[model samples]
Target: MAISLAALRQMILAHPKALAQGLSLLVLAAAYSPVSVLNLSPVYGSAATKLFHRYGMAVTAILGWFLKERIHEMSRGRIARLLPVLAVSIAAIQFLLFKLSSWLGSPFGPVITESFTYYPLLALSIAASAKLIQYATEISRYGETIAEHGPLIASYVVFNLAERISEAFISKVIGSTFLLTRYGLQLVIAALYAITIPSKSLVLTIPLLLLSYTSNVHVPTKHTTAVLNERIQPYGFELIDRRDSLTGYISVLDNLNEGYRVMRADHSLLGGEWTKLPGQYNPKVKDPIYAVFTMLEAVRLVETEPPRPADQDSKALVIGLGIGTTPGSLISHGIDTTIVEIDPVVYYFANKYFHLPHNHTAVIQDAEKFVKKSLASPTSPRYDYIVHDVFTGGAEPINLFTIEFLQQLSDLLKDNGVIAINFAGDLSLYPAGLVVRTIKHVFPSCRIFREDAAMENHPAVDFTNMVVFCTKAAGTPIRFRNPVPADFLGSKARETYLMPKHEIDASAFETIEKGGQRLLKAASVDHIAAFQDRSAIGHWKIMRTVLPDAVWENW
Candidate 1:
């Protein structure tokens, strides 16, 4: 301890300049943090963040040169021999490890999502480049060019700023496609660097670099996964189709074991249906794999306490079509169902795979825009039933859930019309209560129901789907009659889950706590983002539990 104290004293008393330089380097390093570029946009490519680090190192190296710090460089012979040897050795090790793991059935290979050595390697390269400039280029006499590195320095600074600002940016795609493109391009650059160092190879290398850039210019994606050895051979659930949409990752997985197919938005199962023919179909089981899908059908059962109209006579407007579960049932019952789905891919897949009824009105547009337009038009038909079932991955379309939107729906609803909103949240969080409160505020007569009667594991907030049945007729009690055989539409799954059993008493959750009165308006939509994060994490965990790790991981 005394020796350490003496060393510290010496540094503070005598070696202050050295201490300042060391601290400055640390500060520079500390500035280079993992900036989350997950704004859910592909504007910035996967390689962009990696490039930012390189730019930063180059800037720092140029700065060091301007500061008259003597840098270190290796000759062409050293660069050629050392780099190829290093690259080859790493490749050989990785290949051998893969072989060993395959034979021994042991977990091997890089588990890290990305390499930690990436930035360090960039720093080393930049330092070496600066040193090369110092020795070979006669840079000591060319003092004026030091200022010319300003643009490079500015580029580095801009990258850091961009990374910091783009925390919420996420890519729409997260799979092998982006990974292959990103790293493949990077490897080519590395190869070119090794060859380009010698003057003779420039004739060959420049053309190759140009060809590589021209052929493989990266268009960004949301994320990329590290290549894993575990091949994703999903049992029964065959990937019939998949799409990367603005809303989320949509996939249609066919259950080979059950002869059913489901559409998924991100980690949440939107809806599913039985695909087997008459004799092949098991009428009693797995028709609507999830109870929530069938529960959505119960919106048909809401023939008001004030009794507006029966399902056959009702004009139903569905804001979100999740594999057409609710609308399909409505169409089956002869209701004039108009579905508003944002993603064309979802609508296409729904009809092609889930057997969605072709007779109903399909409005392929944003729910808000459609709603606004419908409200504006004097000749627009009012709806007897408006189903706001726009939920996925523990989060709802916040805009659809807003009071302003609900009020707009109210404007579009026929007198005494019913609306069923599907919300997935943890009952323990204030956000859930807030949402319920907002629903109640918009629709005076309403009843909430948990999708399933199953109890939650968490004492505080167990995330689950809950449907709120609201009516245009204020002060009228929300009453639902038991769905008879006719309402089942020859689907026994509807017969089983048409009535939501675990009805939540509004007395407990009707009032939100502090900052609870923040009723969802169009402007302040980001209020639910915090809640969404928690819910999304829970949903991800739940999905992992539902499917094998390899199934989700391989994507």
Candidate 2:
């Protein structure tokens, strides 16, 4: 019963057309698979759990349509009828997997949730390939009808690709243009589909479209004057400009009657001190809980005397510049300060509204990239002080909190240099503990202090900010030198902020549990990803008090 090699070769040569048709279908299935995955990205955040179900149904429907055309024996009605059942089955399987992943305490929970879309697309691709194989078998028995429908098949393939491309384009254009008026666009989409589709199909689609529309409608109207007056406006500021960045909100505010102004990022209360206040000034606050802005003043205090001719010009490197507060302060004290700010909006707002010191150089780049480049070149002068104050949404940048990043800061600093890092978070959380441990691992000497000790000690009552001071040399006590009274008030806005009432105690750091583990310095991408989701949730809750939920929701 064994077939000879010569006979197999002859048969294969005789049915080259069928083989080619089957190969083409397989290629189309593969192409569609990746496109289906790409389609999931936009829906990931909004749909989250339901994304898989929706994409699975869409893929199944598409595959069913394709199969009905290819398999002449199957009626379109029969194939279409099976789509809902298959889609449900796929969704059930994905849901179970998602639940299992969550129960296992795996970091894969989000990935599994996202995979709902991917798995269904994969199933559809397999189904399409199976249908193509069946068609090839039928064509061989029926003397090959595929050749006759070649043009139609090609046109269908082109149409499917065009449809996907058009759908994506329309989705983006509509979503962006009608962002505030999404309900109207949803109605339009529903109406168009209703007019073109059969009654039964329209009935199913309209509800789905409505749900999708409702899920995505993000209007900016859920705001109150109480939020503006109590939380934001009472700071003696009026919001002149605001923009969303990859990091967070960057806003600029001006004093109504006075020439004073301030710039801020969401949850980043005060970045650096006022450099260009209207008149001469003295800081009334001594022993201030060093925020990102005031921490830069440490550079000015590092030197007991003016710079000698032999000494290199005192340079301060600031990793995250919110409103250019620290850099401005450093520049005022005659230090050559270089600020590296990743967000252009923050930089723009600082210069425009905050009246940032005009003398310093601004490098608009990622701190990691800048550090790496500076490290490779030995010619670059080491900084006298490095202020690492890039906090937003009540969480420190996990990447910046790593030991590798801290070591880079150490490399950039002079022998007597000091580095102050501003970290804002709940000390009880694993994120804060991990960050402090990481910093301690990198720098030999470190001191942790809260912005307000009274607030921090009351664990039941959550606090917003904390700063960690670290230096290369061992046993260097954290101190703020030469306290000056507020001489020239920049603005009423500045006056309200500059008054030092919040006192930080070193004793608060004693309560921070290290969890009986030695400090670890290196953190991989996985380490960061593991903590991000929980940290983001914690940050979201903290930020609600800083700004109204409506403001964050609107963004």
Q: Find the candidate with the highest TM-score and give its number.
A: 1
TM-score per model over all chains? 0.66, 0.55
What C-alpha lDDT values do all the predictions have?
A: 0.57, 0.49
lDDT value, residue 49 of candidate 2 = 22
Per-residue lDDT of 95 in model 1:
26
Off by over 4 Å in 1: 1-234, 276-286, 310-312, 454-461, 515-518
Q: Whole-model lDDT for model 1 versus the true structure?
A: 0.57
- lDDT tens digits by residue: candidate 1, 1-555: 122565435434554443333233222232322311111111111122233444445554455444333333334324322332232122223222322321322011121111222233334333443333334333233345543463235334644564454322222232235432322323433454445343333344454434433332122222211112113333545565665555555667766766777787654677777776578445322367777767777776776655667667879898888888778777877889899998777898888887787999999898889999998888899998888878754466677777898889999887877788888767777677877888888888888888766465645447788888888677778777777877676667777788888988887776667775547777787776666656655555556566654444333
The candidate scoring highest on lDDT is 1
Task: Tell me the deviation in Å of residue 314 in model 2.
Answer: 1.8
Candidate 2 lDDT trough over 10 residues, lowest sum: 40-49
